[model samples]
Target: FNFLGYNVNVNSLLANPYCKYTECCNDDWIKFRRNRLMRNLTNHVYGQPLLQHAVDALTSHFNPNFQNHKALVLSFHGMTGTGKNYVSNFIADSLYINGVKSKYVHHFIGRLHFPDESKIPQYKEYLYNNLKAAIKDCPRQLFIFDEVDKTPPEVLNSIKPMVDYRDDVDGVNYSEAVFIFLSNIGADVIREHFHDLYFEKGRQREDLQMIDFEFLIQKGAFNEKGGLFHGDIIANSLIDHYIPFLPLQEEHVKKCILNEFQIRNVNLPKPEHVEHVLKFVEWGPDESLLFAKTGCKRLSSKVALLVDKYYRHESRIHNEL
Candidate 1:
């Protein structure tokens, strides 16, 4: 008998003298839940049209009949605290069964993994070998490179073959693998573009299209004097998409604080207390800038401090009464 493209010897198993029952094993559906991923992304990620494109790319790549590219390559670029890392976490959690803890997922930090420029060659070999070995074990693997701007250019170029379309490498087909690169490079360009569209051009933030920011970011990353500089990944168009993450505004920061409060199970009777917490968060260098410089990176700690202060104030009042 045949089951789901697999040949099964049902008669042999049934005729076995000691066999009591027969069982069949088939391939597991390793893709993520689309609706769950989309919902979670919408709830967490704010004001970035690139995120929607990311969702579409992921969906298309995971489709069983997709034949365009052998691998999915995504480059996430933006300012710090702008949900770049957050979105990466969301993708991992939504796709893999074990989330970030999955053995099929691999993470590498640029500074931590390859800090010394002198070791670029060694790092490149190591990266290729590790990826080859990992994909050999499981083809449906996800690899994330954080702080990619800090990585050496040579090191970044080493993985071009893996990200590009190819039949096989040493009898191992890695077409099913996914690669994500996160960087703070080209942040200024993104910020400038946002300012131009919203402030100068009188364009609404909601009306901004993915095309508005995509090309400019690609131009910045490819031409910028950094790790991704002079790399064929961008030059040869190996990257499927360059996703830009926008800076967080005050309102968005407030929402983040509220979300943090809910996660920590802290209840504040007065909504004004949330505003009080905002005071603790420092702004960017330029006072003219409306967006938070560090983004929500420091908001959680500030929120904690404010909550502590609020509780202490309550305690003192009760004691006096």
Candidate 2:
């Protein structure tokens, strides 16, 4: 059965560790897991074979011992619009497909908070409540925390329990969960710091001065490889700055790539699809309708209602015709 774009092998992928989540049972979980894993592959850096190997390894490992590890923490750092969120979700989804439950995929980001100790308890309480809810559903799950570095130390500390010990709730140790932290910090900082090397190493042959991510980083901006910085320097800074976490090295990125290509089994859609959808959203039926929708004379909500009326009128006319 084809579930979530993955070829399902119910007897194989989900032979062990029965999934407790109802939505993720039999072949459905495997399908979801494959999709998630495939998405992470797109962020794979070039020349990093280990990254691909790692993804493959995970795919291979899931079938036999799917429920063994609590969580697979994937901590990656890069620039904005570099597919950080996408990759993290991809990993989460892939794991879901391999009999991993949807409850396991927890996508978290930092929320703005005032620097006040009084608010800490309230904040922590809220977090604890949510964590309790998540654990109750699926004890063994994966949590994907996006924008990890951008989060404050307090917030980071709050999550450390889950990532390190596999449980977030106080006095409870849930070792069946996995944590994956994705960030656009370390690699981004490195690229900005050592951008000169990309220019000096005969990398950008073009005359364009303001280097965007594409030119500097050959394999797109998000991957640790070809972003407006030297690879070696980025590697070194990653080693120094992120001592224990390991700032998603080239090999790690390779795993992301392999996961992307293998799991999806479908090439990434062309830019035209995105452009078409955006244009469709922007386009209006008539000139007056366009201006009305653009909020020239009313609030956006009012304009949306007007657009809906116009569309209804148009539909009536078409039906009559």
Candidate 3:
């Protein structure tokens, strides 16, 4: 067989299974080497404590010396555009050499994949089969469930067995696999708690610790109306960590806008141009303390439009000159 201009023996390659797939692994490694997951994550606007905890968890999971390792189950709860999904993608990119595109990474969107509540049983079975197959193929598989708050309890519970620490399941070991759940189930509580601490209590955002917010978020998620309602996963302590994403303040949104400008290589005419661009974004319902309802989700397009307008005006001025 000729592959990439190299003449190879098909029979010999088949005889040596490891050699047959060496190219694939090497390619993945090359991709991984180019990714700066930790650096990129640190550059994000997440709190210092959250970033530290996440880094610790990921490092421990990647450490070969770590013993009695179960699958790292992380449940990210917070508001939309608060970086839950972004962080999940970062973890996926960090773990496998190919990042989110790696065969070992599996993403499931709750609303898109399991919308019908009546067919939860079917969804559960599908989730189980796909997860098992993925883990069977690669023990280090990463499973990300986005919008978990929208997923039915029954469907979410299907992976409890796999999330558990086990030597093997039906002769396949998945102890090294990772499960990440992204949700907005406890966003309001988290935001309110921070508001009280920052405003009423006169505490700095950094002073507001995880211990102060984790309990409230967890309680909200387990309530009847919450996503994990009546599920044994939380009660039985199946999840290892419940990371809360803080609501983005106006400053954070501005930073996000600047990041977008950098990504698109667009320069603003002035520093205040960021604020001007922000006017296009709708704020939260509260008229007093303004915050971006959708965080930086729509900031990119807004920035792009503003930059285009600036360039068009400049072009017209140059033509007149």
Write candidate 2's Cα lDDT for 162-219 as tens digits. Answer: 5442334465555555555555445534344233334355443122222333233333
Backbone collisions counted per model: 0, 30, 0
In candidate 1, list every pair of residues with a backbone clash.
none
Report the alpha-carbon TM-score of model 1 versus the true structure. 0.86
lDDT of 1: 0.80
- lDDT by residue for model 3 (26-55), tens: 333423321377687768655434655666
Two-way lDDT contest, 1 vs 2, winner? 1
C-alpha lDDT of all candidate models, in order: 0.80, 0.42, 0.74
What's the lDDT for residue 208 in model 3? 63
Using lDDT as the yardstick, the better of models 1 and 3 is 1
- TM-score, every prediction: 0.86, 0.46, 0.84
Residue 47 shift from truth in candidate 1, angstroms: 2.3
Q: Write the per-residue lDDT of candidate 1 for residues 13-65, one digit (tens) a residue.
A: 66655423321111232566678789888887776766888889889987878
The lDDT-based order of candidates, best leading, equals 1, 3, 2
Please give the lDDT score for candidate 2.
0.42
TM-score: the better of candidates 2 and 3? 3
Point out the higher-scoring one by TM-score: 1 or 3.
Answer: 1
